[model samples]
Target: MFIDASTNSLTVSHRPTNAPSGLIESLKQYPTANVGDAMDRLNLMDTGIASQWANGRCVGPALTVLTREGDNLAIHRALDDAEPGDVLVINALGGTTRAVFGDLLAEICLAKGIAGVIIDGLTRDRAAIKELGLPVWARGVSPAGPAKYGPGAVSVPVACGGTVVNPGDLITADDDGVAVIPVERAQSVLSRLADIDKFEEDLRVRIRNSAVHAAAPAMASTN
Candidate 1:
């Protein structure tokens, strides 16, 4: 497909549909930090994408978009073409001066049932976005708007948040941050996260019990 550079026309291919089912639900049981710990056990580095949500979490397969700095034509195309439960993982080359998305586009994503947006650039309309309750993770927020003109591609592998995101890769984000699990590694990562969750829970209980035991001696001495 040919894109018109003059118009910033976008050519989008179908997003991959083979994401593992139930993994997203399973991931939701743990925080992004726990998930990151699990990925670390496998030597996967942090995604480095900051979570911008006023509330709630985001979990889904990625629909990758690669665009020129300060341009978001491909992002608009990705929104139109992405399936439900797909996170629009955008690589804007780490441009921080211009916001690639705003409240208006976020409304479109909500209406279309997009899981969330993770931009490696900037976003605007922070107040409205928080009110609207859309999960948005980005490098920063800028009031400067992006140009529609683009040299970009949709549904292609892109470097986002200091990580390489391929279409259909599992994207999980929350108050902590975002993490990308490769499509081929989702199952193993999920299993590891489960183990981590259990370990953390046990540690929490042990710490509480020890604290109680330590305080019991002081209480008895006072009596």
Candidate 2:
């Protein structure tokens, strides 16, 4: 895709090299918690960026977008180049007073086959977005609208919910929150997920077999 060089605002960066086919499906099998464990919890997005609807979960390559706080012209532009199953991982500087995008944009994501969106800023129209079944994780929602200005970039490295997201980084998100897995770490994380799953299952078995408070771990993040 051509990056439009005509304007100082609304710049574009190169897209990421694609990951293996079916990678998103493989990552989807594990929940965010297991993904976090596999990465030593260092790449997980902050808990503040949470699901806007119940039962929301998705995994896809990041199409990173960076915009000024409370603005979304670049977000609309990013969709033009989005491939099916791409997830828009947007960094909006965590602005809360106004929304960067809302249900109207989400409908576009659905039409484009985009997997979902994770925003470091806010959005409105939660009810309508929930009805659309387009997964969205954001800091919060506000009724306020956003400015439609440029000065943002698409397909660039961006920070969302405290995690540095590069284009093509795998975004694994669910009820628990989002985890970012750089392409380089994808294999290592996949390798460790099984061990984390097994250890967790074994602990569940232990808790089930025992009948006392002591059956639980001294400290556990599993609850």
Candidate 1 TM-score, true structure as reference = 0.90
Q: Model 1: per-residue lDDT, tens digit, 1-223?
A: 1223353466666677857567777776777777778777332224455766656688898889988889988887777676778888899998988999899889888888888888888999988988998899988898999888887899888888667888898888887777888888888888887788788889999999999999999999998
Q: Per-residue CA lDDT of candidate 2, range 1-223, in tens?
A: 1223333578988797778867667888899988998988789888899999889999989999999998888888888889998989999999989999788898888988999899999989999999989999999999999887668999988888888899999998899999999998898788899789899999998887774556467545466
TM-scores for the candidates: 0.90, 0.88
Clashing pairs in 1: none
At residue 15, give the lDDT of candidate 1.
Answer: 74
The lDDT of each candidate is 0.80, 0.87
RMSD of model 1 against the true structure:
3.0
Candidate 2 deviant stretches above 4 angstroms: 1-8, 211-223
Top-lDDT structure, candidate number: 2
What are the clash counts of all predictions, listed in order? Answer: 0, 0
